[model samples]
Structure formats: C-alpha cells, structure tokens
Target: MDDITRDLVTLRDYWRYAISRFNKADLSYGHGTSTAGDDAAFLLLDSLDLPIDALDPFLDARLLPSERKLLAERIETRVTTRKPSAYLTGRSYIQGVRFHVDERVIVPRSHIGEILFREYLGELGSSFLPDPMAVESAVDICTGSGCLAVLAAKFFPQAEVDAVDLSGDALEVAKLNLAEHEVEQQVSLHEGDLFAPLAGRTYDLIITNPPYVDHEALDGYPPEYRAEPRLAHDGGVDGLDLVRRILDEAAAHLNPGGGMICEIGSGREILEEEYPHLDFVWLETASSQDAVFWLSAEALGVE
Candidate 1:
C-alpha cells in the first residue's frame, strides 16, 4: 500500500494494481460485477465518487493524497476481508440503476431487472406484460434495497408499487434507495414476510426475488456470500420455500389478467418436479436461461 501510494497516480494505474491483487486473492465477485477487472474498476470508480460506467474518461486523471489513501484501504480491505465491494462502497446497480446498500441487504443483482427492461423495451415487450400503461398497481416481494420496486415504478409509471420485506433493517436501507430514486411517492415500503403485509391488496403485477438459496448451498458459500444476512438467502431445505409461498399466493393477489415474475436462482428443476400441473415460462437472460420464470394469473388457475 505504501508503494502504491507513491507509484499509482492515475486511476488507470490503480485499476491495474487492483485487478492484480483481486485476481491473486481469488476474490469472489458478482455484486454488480462478474470479473476481477470489472470488480476493480467498479470499486475504484466508486471510491473516487466517479461515474461507475465512465471510467475511460478518468483513467488518466491524477488522484490527491487523500484519494490515494482511501483507494489503498478499500482495495486492501476488499482482498483481505472478503466483504463485497458494494458493502464497502455502500452502493450497487441493477441494469445501470443505482441503489445504496450495506450488510443489511444482499447487493441487488436479480435477473428480474433484465426481464423488466425487456417487458418495456426489448423484443419481448408486452410478452411478460401486455401493456405497461394499463398496469395500475404492482408489488415487489423481498424488496431488499428496493431496486426492483424502483424499476417497476419506472417501467409502469402509472402504477403504485408496494414493496415487502421481513427485515426492518432491509426496509430501512430500501427507504434510502426509494428516496434516492425519487420514486418515494410511487413505491410504498412494508416490513413483513412476502405478501403478508399486503393482505387483500391485489395488484396488476407481482415481482419477487426472495431468499432462494437452499441451506446446503448456503453452508458452502464463500465468505463474500455468507457476509450477507442469512435470512436473505436461506430458502429452506430446497431454496424454494419463499418461492413456493409466493407462487401459491401470487395469483390471488394479481388481477385475472395480471401476472407474476420471479427469480428462483437455480430452482427451476425443483419447481417443475413439485408443481407438475403448471408450466413455468422460463425467461432467458444474458447469463442464464433458468434463473427466472413468468406465469400469468390465468396460468396460476385464478378466475
């Protein structure tokens, strides 16, 4: 770190050094980034309060002594502590939408964001959703930092969103994000189990990325994943406990023509085996084919 302070003057220099250290440390990623290079760049840009995506412009810019010290500490901490970079910086992004985060919530990286983008803009437009404009109400179960709730509010600007979470700590973090995105008026936050806080409150659409990591997997998770709240990841014996609850109740909460989209991690097989009577429309994203699923109220057998 002392050598880095004297030698690394530009963001580019720090970027190279950070990547080297991150790769050598064999740190696990996937909190808004997937690789060593991306992780290094995200943390470096975030530490300097620079545009996370606009790194090229500032690569050559020199850093102050204060800035260098902060970067050094952050870089070392990321390698040694195994705490996710998002927790270190207190921020994360889903499809370029930023949200504040800490140990209180899992860093927002659900495939639902990709699907929501498609529902409104991609070729799949109106496939998962017939008309975004017609949607008057929606809910985001396991809202965490409320990233999906914010996206839902944007995608369906006319809809009122109710976001639910069992953790008051997570809901508190979500409060900051709701205010940060200025969707405070459109999205309401509730603290309770999935759909528990929204009893009798039906909606035109429902979205959830609940805790779906089974206990077996949770035990083998590296320090980076384990650092997060166990309540956010433990999905019971099969990682589908919360998902099943949402699936069982979502149709009742949705309008007859409405639908639900859920991210179940890798539980597609488990779900199919359990619910053989229903067809789960698996949605494909850049990284995975079975990570998310969609089913309309009619499919869920709602009248």
Candidate 2:
C-alpha cells in the first residue's frame, strides 16, 4: 500500500486524496453530483456510513485503519470504473431523502425534485397546483429509482401515487426505493410504457422525468452515463418521442383542476416551437431554469 493509504490518519486526508484522484481521472459526472469534489465527498461518506452532507464537521476526525483501506479501494475503483458514486455506494439522495439505486435505473437528479419539495411544499409558494393535502391522486411516469414517486408520496402524504416505468428492471430498483421509504402502501409500481397500464385512471397531479436525451448525446455519453441503462436516457431522434406522447395523452388522464409537471432537459426550444398553441408554463429551480414545465388539465383541454 502507498504511504498515504497506509498512514493517512483523518477523514480530511482521505477526502482530499479522493478529490485529487477523481479530478486526475477526468471522470464524467451528473448522476446526482456535478464535479469531482462532490463525487469524492459522497463516495467517502457513504462508504463510511456517515451523514452525507455533514462532512466538514467530521473532516478532522481520525479515521480507523479499516476505514482508510476501504476508502482507498473505493477511490481507485471510482476512477478505474467511472461508475457514478451513487451506484458505487448503492444509494442516492434528493432533497435530503435517500433512495437505493443501481445500474438498473438512472441516478435521480431531476429538477422536478426541487419543485416538489420547494414549490409544492410552499417554500416558493407553488402557483400551478392545489395544496398538498387537497391532492387526491398523483402519478410519476418514467419513475426510475422511484425517487420522485417517493418524494411525491412524502410531499403529498394523503395522495395515492402511481409510479410507472418502461423497464421492468428499472421498476425493480424503484420497488426497493419505494419500500425503503415505507411508501409501498402509498405508491404503486407499474411496469409498462408511459400511461399504457393506467387506462381509465386519472390523477390530480402528474410528475414525469422521462428519457429526454437526444440520440447524438446518447451516442456520445461518457462512461459514467453509459453505465446506466439506455432505456432511462434515450429519448429517440429528437429527444421528444415520449414527451410528445405524454403531451398528446396527458389531457385525457388528468382530473379536473389537475396539472402535470415534467422535466425535458434541453427540449424547451423544440417543445415551444412544436407546440406553440399550448400555453406551457416553464418552471425554474435552484440549479435549473426553464428545463421543466407545468401544464394544467384546462390548458390540456380535459374532456
């Protein structure tokens, strides 16, 4: 073992080393983390079973010899495999809530998560939907890892949640998360193409973060992204194959006074140009602006 791995004495030492190794590898990020430093911190914390966000407080704390060995292997594995720290650690978090994750599903990093917790929870005073307690039914389509569905259930406790995903394997991962959150009673999992299995069912709220990456982007995905299942990110030639379907069919599946919030990454301009007649209300979050949109049943022409 190297001197650092053999003699490193503190979490701070491991933290700095992880950051350097990650940066040296030029590893691609985006699955819940955006930079080498962020990935390093998460990997170290998760491996040690410590609080993920409470790192600085523990940085100067001494590390056990076994902890040092574990961190060393993990830091090297991260650089060598280029796997997202979420997958490496078998966990991911959104809005302070943790979810079990794996290669079966894409890492949960939707901006809709912020809107659900911030705006819908009234931190920013949501203007699109009714109060959480007033909502009776909701759906999370393309519910990879079931992160958003869990968030929806937690944010709107009284509402019944339906989480749908096209990949049965992805649904398996979602199942773990739903159960982990103790929302199996509140959130139902369905394996099928979007809305196909929800026939004759309408929801008061809908939140979807579907596969919206264009073909060009998919073809060029770095190792980190390519590690995830293709079904979670492939949005077809123009990246709107499923989004178009949702826009076309959502009106019929929405109850009176209901609305849908969806994440489309970079499809804002194309969506605006293609569906100019529909009044789409773009939403902004702490890290994203206009990447998500809100559509109401009335605007969708509920029949």
Q: Pick the candidate with the highest lDDT.
A: 1
Provide TM-scores for the models. Answer: 0.96, 0.96
- TM for candidate 2 is 0.96
lDDT of 2 by residue, 1-303 (tens): 467777788999988888888888899988777888888899999999998888899999988888898888888889899888888889888877888989988888879888777776665667776788989899999998899999889888889999998899988988888778899999999989999999999999999999999999999999999999998899999899999999999998899899999999889999999998889998888877888999988889874
The segments of candidate 1 whose C-alpha lies over 4 angstroms from its true place after superposition are: none
What are the C-alpha RMSDs, in order, of all predicted structures?
A: 1.4, 1.4
| Model 1 residue 124 distance off true place after TM-score fit, in angstroms | 6.9
- Least well predicted 10-residue stretch by lDDT in candidate 1: 121-130
Task: Please write out the lDDT profile of model 1 over residues 108-161, one tens digit for every residue.
Answer: 898889877766886656655659888999999999888999998998889999
